[model samples]
Target: MRIAALLGASGATGQKLLPLLLDDPRYDKIITLGRRATGLRHRKLEDRVVDFENLAAGFDGLKVDDCYCTFGTTIKIAGSEAAMTRIDHDFVLAFAKAALAAGATRFAYLSAANADSRSPVFYARLKGRTEEALKTLDFADLGIYRPGMIVAERTDRRWAESLLFPALPLLDKVMIGGLAKFRSIPVETLAAAIAAFSMQRGCGTRIHHWQDMVTA
Candidate 1:
Protein backbone atom coordinates (compact mmCIF):
# COMPACT_ATOMS: atom_id res chain seq x y z
CA MET A 1 0.00 0.00 0.00
CA ARG A 2 1.13 3.52 -0.79
CA ILE A 3 0.83 6.75 1.17
CA ALA A 4 -0.26 9.61 -1.09
CA ALA A 5 0.02 13.35 -0.51
CA LEU A 6 -2.31 15.66 -2.41
CA LEU A 7 -2.25 19.45 -2.89
CA GLY A 8 -5.27 21.51 -4.00
CA ALA A 9 -7.75 18.96 -2.69
CA SER A 10 -10.55 21.53 -2.84
CA GLY A 11 -10.07 22.59 -6.43
CA ALA A 12 -12.21 21.31 -9.31
CA THR A 13 -9.86 18.52 -10.44
CA GLY A 14 -8.70 17.84 -6.91
CA GLN A 15 -12.26 17.51 -5.61
CA LYS A 16 -13.04 14.97 -8.31
CA LEU A 17 -9.77 13.10 -7.72
CA LEU A 18 -10.16 12.89 -3.92
CA PRO A 19 -12.98 10.34 -3.89
CA LEU A 20 -11.27 8.24 -6.57
CA LEU A 21 -8.06 8.14 -4.53
CA LEU A 22 -10.02 7.09 -1.45
CA ASP A 23 -11.71 4.25 -3.35
CA ASP A 24 -8.48 2.91 -4.84
CA PRO A 25 -7.06 -0.01 -2.85
CA ARG A 26 -3.44 0.79 -3.75
CA TYR A 27 -3.29 3.74 -1.39
CA ASP A 28 -3.50 3.07 2.33
CA LYS A 29 -3.42 6.75 3.31
CA ILE A 30 -4.49 9.86 1.40
CA ILE A 31 -3.12 13.06 2.95
CA THR A 32 -4.51 16.35 1.70
CA LEU A 33 -2.56 19.58 2.33
CA GLY A 34 -4.40 22.79 1.66
CA ARG A 35 -5.60 26.10 3.11
CA ARG A 36 -8.92 24.65 4.28
CA ALA A 37 -10.68 21.38 5.00
CA THR A 38 -11.98 19.21 2.18
CA GLY A 39 -14.98 18.40 4.42
CA LEU A 40 -14.57 14.80 3.36
CA ARG A 41 -14.28 11.93 5.79
CA HIS A 42 -12.90 8.50 5.03
CA ARG A 43 -10.97 5.89 6.98
CA LYS A 44 -7.92 6.45 4.79
CA LEU A 45 -8.16 10.23 4.48
CA GLU A 46 -6.04 12.72 6.43
CA ASP A 47 -6.62 16.40 5.75
CA ARG A 48 -4.00 18.89 6.91
CA VAL A 49 -4.74 22.59 6.77
CA VAL A 50 -1.50 24.32 5.83
CA ASP A 51 -0.08 27.76 5.17
CA PHE A 52 1.61 27.48 1.77
CA GLU A 53 4.13 30.21 2.51
CA ASN A 54 5.41 28.26 5.53
CA LEU A 55 4.91 24.71 4.30
CA ALA A 56 8.25 23.31 5.49
CA ALA A 57 7.58 24.22 9.11
CA GLY A 58 4.16 22.51 9.07
CA PHE A 59 4.92 19.51 6.80
CA ASP A 60 7.39 17.70 9.02
CA GLY A 61 5.17 14.86 10.24
CA LEU A 62 3.71 13.77 6.93
CA LYS A 63 5.13 10.69 5.19
CA VAL A 64 4.13 10.02 1.60
CA ASP A 65 5.22 7.78 -1.29
CA ASP A 66 3.62 9.84 -4.03
CA CYS A 67 2.55 13.48 -4.34
CA TYR A 68 -0.13 14.96 -6.59
CA CYS A 69 -0.60 18.70 -7.20
CA THR A 70 -3.72 20.19 -8.75
CA PHE A 71 -3.31 23.66 -7.28
CA GLY A 72 -3.88 26.62 -9.62
CA THR A 73 -5.45 30.06 -9.89
CA THR A 74 -6.25 32.61 -12.58
CA ILE A 75 -4.70 36.06 -12.86
CA LYS A 76 -8.16 37.62 -12.76
CA ILE A 77 -9.06 35.93 -9.50
CA ALA A 78 -5.64 36.59 -7.97
CA GLY A 79 -6.01 40.32 -8.83
CA SER A 80 -2.43 40.59 -10.12
CA GLU A 81 0.24 38.69 -12.01
CA ALA A 82 2.54 38.63 -8.99
CA ALA A 83 -0.10 37.07 -6.74
CA MET A 84 -0.98 34.50 -9.40
CA THR A 85 2.71 33.58 -9.80
CA ARG A 86 3.12 33.21 -6.04
CA ILE A 87 0.27 30.69 -5.92
CA ASP A 88 0.75 28.91 -9.24
CA HIS A 89 4.54 28.74 -9.27
CA ASP A 90 6.05 29.55 -5.89
CA PHE A 91 3.59 27.74 -3.63
CA VAL A 92 3.48 24.64 -5.80
CA LEU A 93 7.26 24.18 -5.75
CA ALA A 94 7.30 24.80 -2.01
CA PHE A 95 4.80 22.01 -1.39
CA ALA A 96 6.60 19.69 -3.82
CA LYS A 97 9.89 20.21 -2.03
CA ALA A 98 8.23 19.51 1.31
CA ALA A 99 6.60 16.37 -0.05
CA LEU A 100 9.97 15.14 -1.32
CA ALA A 101 11.46 15.74 2.11
CA ALA A 102 8.65 13.56 3.49
CA GLY A 103 9.90 10.71 1.24
CA ALA A 104 7.67 10.98 -1.78
CA THR A 105 9.12 9.09 -4.76
CA ARG A 106 6.65 10.14 -7.44
CA PHE A 107 5.13 13.51 -8.30
CA ALA A 108 2.19 14.38 -10.51
CA TYR A 109 1.27 17.91 -11.58
CA LEU A 110 -1.76 19.14 -13.52
CA SER A 111 -0.54 21.65 -16.09
CA ALA A 112 -2.25 23.26 -19.07
CA ALA A 113 -2.02 22.92 -22.84
CA ASN A 114 0.43 25.17 -24.71
CA ALA A 115 2.62 25.47 -21.62
CA ASP A 116 5.99 26.74 -22.71
CA SER A 117 8.61 28.36 -20.56
CA ARG A 118 9.43 30.81 -23.32
CA SER A 119 5.85 31.56 -24.24
CA PRO A 120 4.79 35.18 -24.55
CA VAL A 121 1.55 34.38 -22.73
CA PHE A 122 1.78 34.90 -18.99
CA TYR A 123 -0.27 31.92 -17.83
CA ALA A 124 1.39 29.45 -20.18
CA ARG A 125 4.81 30.79 -19.26
CA LEU A 126 4.10 30.30 -15.56
CA LYS A 127 2.88 26.76 -16.10
CA GLY A 128 5.93 25.98 -18.17
CA ARG A 129 8.25 27.39 -15.54
CA THR A 130 6.54 25.29 -12.88
CA GLU A 131 6.99 22.16 -14.99
CA GLU A 132 10.65 22.92 -15.56
CA ALA A 133 11.24 23.53 -11.87
CA LEU A 134 9.68 20.16 -11.00
CA LYS A 135 11.98 18.40 -13.46
CA THR A 136 15.04 19.82 -11.68
CA LEU A 137 14.00 17.90 -8.53
CA ASP A 138 14.62 14.61 -10.39
CA PHE A 139 12.10 12.41 -8.58
CA ALA A 140 11.94 8.68 -9.39
CA ASP A 141 8.86 9.42 -11.51
CA LEU A 142 7.35 12.72 -12.64
CA GLY A 143 4.10 13.02 -14.56
CA ILE A 144 3.05 16.36 -16.01
CA TYR A 145 -0.41 16.43 -17.52
CA ARG A 146 -1.11 19.26 -19.98
CA PRO A 147 -4.84 19.35 -20.40
CA GLY A 148 -6.82 21.79 -22.53
CA MET A 149 -10.00 23.59 -21.46
CA ILE A 150 -11.25 21.59 -18.48
CA VAL A 151 -15.01 21.24 -18.47
CA ALA A 152 -16.45 21.38 -14.95
CA GLU A 153 -18.78 23.28 -12.64
CA ARG A 154 -16.80 25.89 -10.72
CA THR A 155 -17.74 27.77 -7.58
CA ASP A 156 -15.97 30.92 -8.77
CA ARG A 157 -17.58 32.30 -11.88
CA ARG A 158 -15.81 33.58 -15.00
CA TRP A 159 -17.99 35.49 -17.45
CA ALA A 160 -16.01 34.53 -20.56
CA GLU A 161 -15.68 30.92 -19.50
CA SER A 162 -19.39 30.71 -18.75
CA LEU A 163 -20.18 31.83 -22.26
CA LEU A 164 -17.77 29.33 -23.82
CA PHE A 165 -18.51 26.28 -21.64
CA PRO A 166 -21.78 25.32 -23.30
CA ALA A 167 -20.34 25.34 -26.80
CA LEU A 168 -17.18 23.37 -25.97
CA PRO A 169 -18.77 19.99 -26.65
CA LEU A 170 -19.82 21.01 -30.14
CA LEU A 171 -16.42 22.63 -30.68
CA ASP A 172 -14.67 19.47 -29.45
CA LYS A 173 -16.18 17.41 -32.26
CA VAL A 174 -14.73 19.71 -34.87
CA MET A 175 -11.35 20.00 -33.16
CA ILE A 176 -9.71 17.00 -34.84
CA GLY A 177 -6.15 16.04 -35.83
CA GLY A 178 -3.60 18.54 -34.52
CA LEU A 179 -6.42 20.42 -32.83
CA ALA A 180 -7.35 17.37 -30.75
CA LYS A 181 -5.18 18.55 -27.91
CA PHE A 182 -7.40 21.61 -27.64
CA ARG A 183 -10.52 19.49 -27.15
CA SER A 184 -12.05 20.10 -23.79
CA ILE A 185 -12.13 17.22 -21.32
CA PRO A 186 -14.35 16.50 -18.32
CA VAL A 187 -12.81 17.04 -14.87
CA GLU A 188 -13.78 13.51 -13.81
CA THR A 189 -11.89 11.92 -16.71
CA LEU A 190 -8.83 14.05 -16.00
CA ALA A 191 -8.99 13.15 -12.32
CA ALA A 192 -9.20 9.43 -13.06
CA ALA A 193 -6.22 9.67 -15.39
CA ILE A 194 -4.14 11.39 -12.72
CA ALA A 195 -5.04 8.70 -10.15
CA ALA A 196 -4.27 5.89 -12.57
CA PHE A 197 -0.98 7.43 -13.69
CA SER A 198 0.23 7.86 -10.11
CA MET A 199 0.19 4.08 -9.67
CA GLN A 200 2.58 3.46 -12.52
CA ARG A 201 6.21 2.95 -11.41
CA GLY A 202 7.86 4.31 -14.50
CA CYS A 203 11.13 6.18 -14.30
CA GLY A 204 12.19 9.56 -15.75
CA THR A 205 9.80 12.34 -16.82
CA ARG A 206 6.61 11.91 -18.87
CA ILE A 207 4.41 14.64 -20.25
CA HIS A 208 0.81 13.65 -20.98
CA HIS A 209 -0.93 15.66 -23.66
CA TRP A 210 -4.69 16.00 -23.99
CA GLN A 211 -4.94 12.82 -26.09
CA ASP A 212 -2.93 10.74 -23.62
CA MET A 213 -5.05 11.92 -20.68
CA VAL A 214 -8.43 11.28 -22.32
CA THR A 215 -7.38 7.78 -23.38
CA ALA A 216 -5.60 6.87 -20.15
Candidate 2:
Protein backbone atom coordinates (compact mmCIF):
# COMPACT_ATOMS: atom_id res chain seq x y z
CA MET A 1 0.00 0.00 0.00
CA ARG A 2 1.16 3.50 -0.88
CA ILE A 3 0.13 6.84 0.58
CA ALA A 4 -0.13 9.71 -1.87
CA ALA A 5 -0.73 13.44 -1.60
CA LEU A 6 -2.02 15.68 -4.43
CA LEU A 7 -1.64 19.44 -4.20
CA GLY A 8 -4.04 20.56 -6.97
CA ALA A 9 -6.68 17.90 -7.22
CA SER A 10 -9.23 20.33 -8.69
CA GLY A 11 -7.18 21.56 -11.63
CA ALA A 12 -7.61 20.22 -15.16
CA THR A 13 -4.86 17.59 -15.07
CA GLY A 14 -5.36 16.85 -11.41
CA GLN A 15 -9.08 16.27 -11.90
CA LYS A 16 -8.42 13.78 -14.67
CA LEU A 17 -5.68 12.07 -12.64
CA LEU A 18 -7.87 11.54 -9.58
CA PRO A 19 -9.93 8.79 -11.20
CA LEU A 20 -6.80 6.89 -12.17
CA LEU A 21 -5.36 6.97 -8.67
CA LEU A 22 -8.70 6.15 -7.10
CA ASP A 23 -9.13 3.21 -9.43
CA ASP A 24 -5.70 1.82 -8.60
CA PRO A 25 -5.71 -0.59 -5.69
CA ARG A 26 -1.98 -0.05 -5.17
CA TYR A 27 -2.69 3.30 -3.56
CA ASP A 28 -4.28 2.60 -0.23
CA LYS A 29 -4.79 6.29 0.65
CA ILE A 30 -4.86 9.58 -1.26
CA ILE A 31 -4.75 12.98 0.41
CA THR A 32 -5.94 15.87 -1.76
CA LEU A 33 -5.01 19.44 -0.78
CA GLY A 34 -6.82 22.31 -2.49
CA ARG A 35 -8.46 25.64 -1.88
CA ARG A 36 -11.93 24.18 -2.41
CA ALA A 37 -13.55 20.76 -2.28
CA THR A 38 -12.88 18.71 -5.43
CA GLY A 39 -16.32 16.99 -5.21
CA LEU A 40 -14.65 13.64 -5.93
CA ARG A 41 -15.83 10.60 -4.06
CA HIS A 42 -13.68 7.74 -2.82
CA ARG A 43 -13.49 5.80 0.41
CA LYS A 44 -9.70 6.05 0.30
CA LEU A 45 -9.63 9.77 -0.59
CA GLU A 46 -9.09 12.42 2.10
CA ASP A 47 -9.49 16.11 1.24
CA ARG A 48 -7.57 18.86 2.97
CA VAL A 49 -8.72 22.45 2.38
CA VAL A 50 -5.86 24.92 2.08
CA ASP A 51 -4.79 28.24 0.58
CA PHE A 52 -1.38 28.52 -1.10
CA GLU A 53 -0.25 31.35 1.16
CA ASN A 54 -0.79 29.23 4.28
CA LEU A 55 0.01 25.79 2.94
CA ALA A 56 2.92 24.87 5.20
CA ALA A 57 0.77 24.97 8.31
CA GLY A 58 -2.11 23.27 6.55
CA PHE A 59 0.06 20.27 5.67
CA ASP A 60 0.64 19.48 9.32
CA GLY A 61 0.48 15.84 10.49
CA LEU A 62 0.34 14.33 7.00
CA LYS A 63 2.85 12.15 5.19
CA VAL A 64 2.83 10.11 2.01
CA ASP A 65 5.01 8.08 -0.34
CA ASP A 66 4.48 10.30 -3.36
CA CYS A 67 3.68 14.03 -3.30
CA TYR A 68 2.10 15.23 -6.55
CA CYS A 69 2.54 18.97 -7.09
CA THR A 70 0.15 20.09 -9.86
CA PHE A 71 -0.41 23.65 -8.57
CA GLY A 72 -0.07 26.43 -11.18
CA THR A 73 -1.67 29.68 -12.35
CA THR A 74 -1.44 32.26 -15.14
CA ILE A 75 -0.11 35.77 -14.77
CA LYS A 76 -3.41 37.24 -15.91
CA ILE A 77 -5.36 35.21 -13.37
CA ALA A 78 -2.74 35.69 -10.62
CA GLY A 79 -2.84 39.48 -11.26
CA SER A 80 0.95 40.04 -11.31
CA GLU A 81 4.25 38.29 -11.92
CA ALA A 82 5.09 38.41 -8.21
CA ALA A 83 1.78 36.78 -7.30
CA MET A 84 2.19 34.15 -9.96
CA THR A 85 5.68 33.30 -8.74
CA ARG A 86 4.42 33.16 -5.20
CA ILE A 87 2.08 30.34 -6.12
CA ASP A 88 4.10 28.68 -8.87
CA HIS A 89 7.51 28.90 -7.24
CA ASP A 90 7.23 29.86 -3.58
CA PHE A 91 4.17 27.86 -2.68
CA VAL A 92 5.40 24.86 -4.59
CA LEU A 93 8.69 24.91 -2.74
CA ALA A 94 6.92 25.35 0.56
CA PHE A 95 4.75 22.31 -0.03
CA ALA A 96 7.68 20.21 -1.13
CA LYS A 97 9.60 21.16 1.99
CA ALA A 98 6.64 20.42 4.20
CA ALA A 99 6.02 17.11 2.51
CA LEU A 100 9.65 16.12 3.01
CA ALA A 101 9.43 17.06 6.66
CA ALA A 102 6.40 14.83 6.96
CA GLY A 103 8.49 11.88 5.56
CA ALA A 104 7.47 11.93 1.90
CA THR A 105 10.41 10.67 -0.18
CA ARG A 106 9.13 11.14 -3.73
CA PHE A 107 7.97 14.35 -5.42
CA ALA A 108 6.17 14.75 -8.74
CA TYR A 109 5.86 18.18 -10.32
CA LEU A 110 3.77 19.28 -13.33
CA SER A 111 5.82 21.82 -15.22
CA ALA A 112 5.51 23.07 -18.80
CA ALA A 113 7.53 22.81 -21.99
CA ASN A 114 10.33 25.33 -22.60
CA ALA A 115 10.86 25.79 -18.89
CA ASP A 116 14.26 27.40 -18.49
CA SER A 117 15.81 29.35 -15.68
CA ARG A 118 17.27 31.85 -18.18
CA SER A 119 14.14 32.10 -20.32
CA PRO A 120 12.75 35.54 -21.15
CA VAL A 121 9.27 34.28 -20.23
CA PHE A 122 8.21 34.80 -16.62
CA TYR A 123 6.01 31.69 -16.40
CA ALA A 124 8.77 29.44 -17.69
CA ARG A 125 11.23 31.00 -15.32
CA LEU A 126 8.96 30.34 -12.38
CA LYS A 127 8.49 26.73 -13.42
CA GLY A 128 12.21 26.21 -13.90
CA ARG A 129 12.92 27.71 -10.52
CA THR A 130 10.36 25.43 -8.90
CA GLU A 131 11.94 22.41 -10.55
CA GLU A 132 15.35 23.45 -9.35
CA ALA A 133 14.08 23.84 -5.81
CA LEU A 134 12.57 20.39 -5.86
CA LYS A 135 15.88 18.88 -6.90
CA THR A 136 17.52 20.28 -3.78
CA LEU A 137 15.14 18.36 -1.57
CA ASP A 138 16.33 14.97 -0.31
CA PHE A 139 13.65 13.01 -2.06
CA ALA A 140 14.48 9.50 -3.28
CA ASP A 141 12.65 10.23 -6.53
CA LEU A 142 11.78 13.46 -8.35
CA GLY A 143 9.65 13.37 -11.50
CA ILE A 144 9.12 16.54 -13.50
CA TYR A 145 6.56 16.49 -16.32
CA ARG A 146 6.86 19.16 -18.98
CA PRO A 147 3.71 18.55 -20.92
CA GLY A 148 2.71 20.46 -24.05
CA MET A 149 -0.50 22.36 -24.85
CA ILE A 150 -2.96 20.54 -22.56
CA VAL A 151 -6.29 20.18 -24.34
CA ALA A 152 -9.24 20.09 -21.96
CA GLU A 153 -12.73 21.48 -21.54
CA ARG A 154 -12.64 24.42 -19.19
CA THR A 155 -15.32 26.78 -17.99
CA ASP A 156 -13.52 29.87 -19.35
CA ARG A 157 -11.38 30.52 -22.38
CA ARG A 158 -7.59 30.70 -22.23
CA TRP A 159 -7.22 33.21 -25.08
CA ALA A 160 -3.66 32.24 -26.01
CA GLU A 161 -4.17 28.46 -26.21
CA SER A 162 -7.64 28.95 -27.66
CA LEU A 163 -6.16 30.76 -30.68
CA LEU A 164 -3.15 28.48 -31.01
CA PHE A 165 -4.97 25.12 -30.85
CA PRO A 166 -6.85 25.71 -34.08
CA ALA A 167 -3.61 26.31 -36.00
CA LEU A 168 -1.75 23.32 -34.46
CA PRO A 169 -1.94 21.15 -37.58
CA LEU A 170 -0.45 23.83 -39.81
CA LEU A 171 2.04 24.78 -37.14
CA ASP A 172 3.09 21.16 -36.66
CA LYS A 173 3.88 20.86 -40.34
CA VAL A 174 6.15 23.91 -40.48
CA MET A 175 7.51 23.77 -36.94
CA ILE A 176 9.08 20.33 -37.14
CA GLY A 177 11.92 18.83 -35.07
CA GLY A 178 12.87 20.49 -31.78
CA LEU A 179 11.22 23.84 -32.45
CA ALA A 180 7.68 22.54 -33.01
CA LYS A 181 7.29 20.61 -29.80
CA PHE A 182 4.14 22.28 -28.51
CA ARG A 183 1.41 20.06 -29.91
CA SER A 184 -2.16 19.73 -28.69
CA ILE A 185 -1.53 17.14 -26.00
CA PRO A 186 -4.70 15.93 -24.36
CA VAL A 187 -4.98 16.53 -20.60
CA GLU A 188 -5.74 12.88 -20.02
CA THR A 189 -2.43 11.84 -21.54
CA LEU A 190 -0.40 14.05 -19.25
CA ALA A 191 -2.37 12.84 -16.23
CA ALA A 192 -1.82 9.22 -17.17
CA ALA A 193 1.89 9.75 -17.68
CA ILE A 194 2.25 11.27 -14.24
CA ALA A 195 0.33 8.41 -12.64
CA ALA A 196 2.45 5.88 -14.48
CA PHE A 197 5.74 7.57 -13.67
CA SER A 198 4.99 8.03 -9.98
CA MET A 199 4.39 4.32 -9.46
CA GLN A 200 7.87 3.45 -10.61
CA ARG A 201 10.80 3.16 -8.20
CA GLY A 202 13.67 5.40 -9.18
CA CYS A 203 16.16 7.99 -8.08
CA GLY A 204 16.86 11.51 -9.42
CA THR A 205 14.61 13.54 -11.76
CA ARG A 206 12.93 12.53 -15.00
CA ILE A 207 12.07 15.48 -17.26
CA HIS A 208 9.26 14.49 -19.63
CA HIS A 209 9.18 16.88 -22.54
CA TRP A 210 6.01 17.81 -24.43
CA GLN A 211 6.87 15.65 -27.43
CA ASP A 212 7.50 12.71 -25.12
CA MET A 213 4.30 13.37 -23.18
CA VAL A 214 2.15 13.25 -26.32
CA THR A 215 3.69 9.96 -27.33
CA ALA A 216 3.56 8.52 -23.79
Compare the candidates by TM-score and give the number of the best one.
1
Candidate 2 wrongly placed segments (more than 4 Å): none
lDDT of 1 by residue, 9-128 (tens): 989999999999999888999989888889988999998887888977556777789989999999888999999999999999998898889888899999998899999999999999
Please give the RMSD to the true structure for each candidate, in Å.
Answer: 1.2, 1.5
Candidate 1 has what TM-score? 0.96
lDDT of 2 by residue, 1-216 (tens): 788888888789999988788877788899888888788788999898887777777668876788888888888889999888888898889888888888888888999887888888887878888888888889988989987678888776599888987887777677667865565678998898888765677756788876667666
Go through the candidates in order and give each one's C-alpha lDDT.
0.89, 0.82
Per-residue error for 169 in candidate 1, Å, reads 2.2
CA error at residue 168 for candidate 1, angstroms: 1.2
Whose lDDT is greatest here? 1
Which segments of candidate 1 are over 4 A away from where they belong? Answer: none
Model 2 is weakest, by summed lDDT over 10 consecutive residues, at: 175-184
